[model samples]
Structures are given as structure tokens and as C-alpha cells.
Target: MTTSRLARRLLRPPGVYAPQLDTRLLLGALRQEHLVGGAELLDVGTGTGALALSAARRGARVTALDVSHRAVLTARLNARRSRLRVRVLHGDMASLADLTWDLVVSNPPYVPSPRARVPARGPARAWDAGPDGRAVLDTVCDGAADALRPGGVLLLVHSALCGTDATLRKLEGSGLRAAVHRRAVAPYGPVLRSRLPWLRENGLVTDEQPGEELVVIRAVRV
Candidate 1:
């Protein structure tokens, strides 16, 4: 079966983040790395075990982490169904600070929201990242350096609406060499369309902005 099929076949229930454009972008960047066998890897905010299963299929020792219990279960079930070994964990990235991996990847919540705090429950938890959209993004950047071993790599994918330069700066400030590895432009989804006014008022988007730009950021702990 193809690697993409692994994601397509996964079960995604309501409230769990489903594998989408950002997930596929990160997966492409991951494939570019050509990870060696048994390389320790972690997929932060792993929704549906797509990225985790992709890496595991390449023989990487993979651990998939999510804040949602339902997501965790879905990932576990997908792994079992695919006959892939993944250490699926139910928690945010901060919870696994003590552990370091050869590679870390995440397609985290990066949508700017009107709410000051990220949704603790419900489907919004999958994509809403507070007013600036950096609530989770910033946390991921702050913890990324610590989450990787020396010489390890980090592959992260998120929307350009949240600030690509901001993400690069955060990653660099954390002591990792970072840059945009790949990019793709896509039309606004339902979530973004629903809050167009809020996004515009916040200066995250201009009247001229046509669609969302997704980017894959690659960082290495040297």
C-alpha cells in the first residue's frame, strides 16, 4: 500500500483533527529527509497517526502524541490496523520534555482565532490557536530544541497566516537552524471563511489576500 493510503485509511472521528493539506505537506518534507532505519521520531499533535505511520513505515521508531484522547485512540487503532508499531501518547508536547528524538515533526494548530484561549474541548481544539494563533505554535517552538537530540531535525508545517517569519525566528531563537523547506497555496477552508472579518481586523490578512499559504519548516539542532 502507498504511504498516502495509510493516512486515507485512518479513522477520524468528530473533534479529532483529520489529516489534511498541512499533514500532507509535512509528510512530503519527511520523505525528503530519508530517515535511517530505527531513527527515533516524534509526531507532535499527531492527528490520525498519518505522519507517525508514514515514518514508522520507513522503519523509524515513532511516537505519536496528541492532546485529545479520541485522537490518541484513533492513532493507536490506525497503527494496529496497518501493522505499524507506534508509541501513541495522549498529551501535549510539553508533557514529553524529558524525552529527545532523532527527528520531530508536527502539523500543529495555527489558525488565528477570536478567543484568547485555545479551546480545551470540541473540534476547535484541533485548529484554533487563540487570537494570535501562536498559543500552540509558540509552545512548540519553545520546546522543539529540547525535544530533539543534538544533530536531530524538526519538520513542522503550518499556515502562513500565523506568520512564517515569526515561526522561523522562534525556531532560530531556540538555537536551531531553520528555514522554509516547502510551500503550497490553498483556498480558505470553512474555518477560515467563517472568521474572515476577525482575521482581517487582526491584520493577519488583507483584502487582497486570496488564499492560505501553507509552509513546511525544517530545523536542525546542530
Candidate 2:
């Protein structure tokens, strides 16, 4: 099934993030990589297992992890409906520390928010990263090296407002060579639209800005 069709068919209940531009961007980046059959792949923060399903479609041995139980169920349901084999797990990414993959992909919570702490509940958990928007992104970058096998690849997509330079620095510091693999401009969604005033107050956006720039950062462990 095509990515768009798969996305449309996903069972995204309330609070489980719907597949959007960021998800599509990450999927595109993932498609660019050579996914050999049986190659282990991990999708962290798998919302509805869109990326995981995409990888699984390519014959990658895919594991999808999500901190939200609802998301976990949704992903598993989507996988079943798609007739795709994806190991969907419900838990924090840290819970899978013992496992490593040939590819790790994430389109994590990354919208900058006024909340001092990452939301433990609610729909915000899907996008409201605290303050500078690196709450989950930082963790993803830090864990990339350990999550990936030698010479493995990491594909991460997030808002450019979170600072691509910061992501590159973190990935490189983690011993992965990283660069922006793809970029696209997309208008802010309801979450960002609602937070526009706060974003302006925080100087994350300006009055004249058009939209957020989504970037897919691809890093490889050398």
C-alpha cells in the first residue's frame, strides 16, 4: 500500500497522533535508504506505526514502540489491518535498551511549548515538548548511537524550530555522522496554531513567518 493510503487507513483515535507532514517526511527519508529484507528496524514513538508499517512493507524486521498505550493499540490495529507484520510495543523508548537495530526512525514530540514538563497525559503528549522543544528529540539523538548497530542509520524528523544545528550537534556528540536529508515547509497544525501567541512571546516565531520547516535528519553510525 502507498504511504498516503496507509496513512489514511490508520486507526488514529483521539490523543493518538495522526499521520501528518512530519510523518510523511520521515517515511520519505526512510524509503531513500536500502531496507534489506530481515534487516532490523526500530521506530521510536511510533504514533500509528506509519513509519514502522512502511519499513515492514519493505521487508524490514520492524519494531514499533510508543509511550502511549492508546498509540500502541492503534499501531497494532493498523498493522493488522494493513496485513503487515510489525512488533508493536507499549512503553518508553528506554525500555528497549537491550535491542539494537540496523535502522532507527523517529518523528517524535517536538513542538515547543510553555509547559515546563513534558505532558504525561492528553493529546499534547504527541507534540508538546517543553520549552525549547528538545525534550524527546534530545533523548532520541543521545540514544541513536546505542540504538543503532555499527554503521546503522538513524532517520529523525522534527520541526526546524527545535534547531537542526542542536540536533546535529547532539547526534555527532553521540558518535553519529548526521546531516539534514530532507526539508519541507508546512503550516502549523492546530497545536502550533493554538500556541502561536506563546511562540511569539518566546520568540520562537515571528509575526511574518509563514510556517514551520520540517526537517528529516539522517545520521549514520560510523
Residues 115-161, model 1: lDDT tens digits: 99898899999999988888898888999999999999999988998
Per-model C-alpha RMSD: 1.6, 1.3
* 1-222 per-residue lDDT for model 2 (tens digits): 455676678888999988887888887888889987799999999998889988998899999999999999999999999899999998766899988899999989999989889999999999989999999999999888998999899999999999999999999998999999999998878878999999999889998989999999999999
**TM-scores for all candidates?**
0.96, 0.96
Candidate 1 residue 153 Cα shift, in angstroms, is: 0.5
Per-candidate clashes come to 0, 0
Off by over 4 Å in 2: 1-4
How does residue 22 of candidate 2 score in lDDT?
A: 83
* Model 2 vs. true fold: TM: 0.96
TM-score: model 1 vs. ground truth? 0.96
